[model samples]
Each structure stands twice: as C-alpha cells, then as structure tokens.
Target: MTDASIPSDGKWIPQAMSVKYLAKAKTALRAVASGEKVDWDTSGEKTVPVEVFDEDGQRVFTAEITMNVKLN
Candidate 1:
C-alpha cells in the first residue's frame, strides 16, 4: 500500500495496486526447477481488505477488492 498524491486539481491520485503470492511446497519447487515455465491454473478469486485512516489516526473507511489468483 502507498500514500495518495494530490494534484493541482485537488484530486487524489493513488499508486497502482498489486497482489503477490509466496509458495513453499513441492509444486513450487517444481515450478522453480522448471525456471517458472510451467502453465498456470486459475485457482479462484480472493477478497482483499483495505482500510483508510485519517490524519488523526482514526479509521475513516473500509473496503474490499476482489482479485483473480492462479496456481502453478
């Protein structure tokens, strides 16, 4: 997560968001051994929780974003 930047027009421009996954298993080891050249399978969608806080450290809003996930 990153802080938003305000432009001259008084609009907040937030940084690009992304998702990352860490794997530690046989499948992961195989993928690594293959130099990550294996086909990926769609696992499913996941909901990521987000929270917005004000300058006073108070929770102002909360939200969730759905993202598609893949597995090797």
Candidate 2:
C-alpha cells in the first residue's frame, strides 16, 4: 500500500525545483539521469517529497510531486 500524505500547514511552501534534472529526464531519461540503461526504480515514475520547516525547527507543511518519466 502506498501511504502518501501531505501536511496542512500555512507556513511551509515550495520555492523552486530542479529543472535541470527534470528537463534532462524529459529529454533522455535513461541516457541522462539514471544511466545508459533504464533502471526500474527510476525507469518509469518517481515521487518527490518536500518538507517545510519553521525557524523553531518544526515541521509546518509537506508537499509531494510525482514525476513522469518520458523516454525519447
């Protein structure tokens, strides 16, 4: 079972993401990111978890993003 959950806080938020890896992954996923060959774990899909923290060192929010691998 996939136990994926996101927090509901107003503090934590997303600022930016790694466009380089994303663009590379989109262009030639197997050749650029994972390696020359296709890796199962990173072959088709991926899930990215983002954590938001406050100045007091507490978890405020959580965000998850699913990346679809496009092999061309």
Give per-model CA RMSD.
18.3, 17.9
- Residue-level lDDT of model 2, residues 4-72, one tens digit each, is 222222122233444222211212112112222323233334445555444544444454544444332
User: What is candidate 1's local distance difference test score?
Assistant: 0.33
The parts of candidate 1 lying over 4 Å away from their true place are 1-42
Which candidate wins on TM-score?
1
Global lDDT of each model?
A: 0.33, 0.34
**Model 2 ranges off by over 4 Å:** 1-41
Model 2 poorest 10 in a row by lDDT: 23-32
Model 1: lowest-lDDT 10 consecutive positions: 27-36
**In candidate 2, residue 34 scores what lDDT?**
23
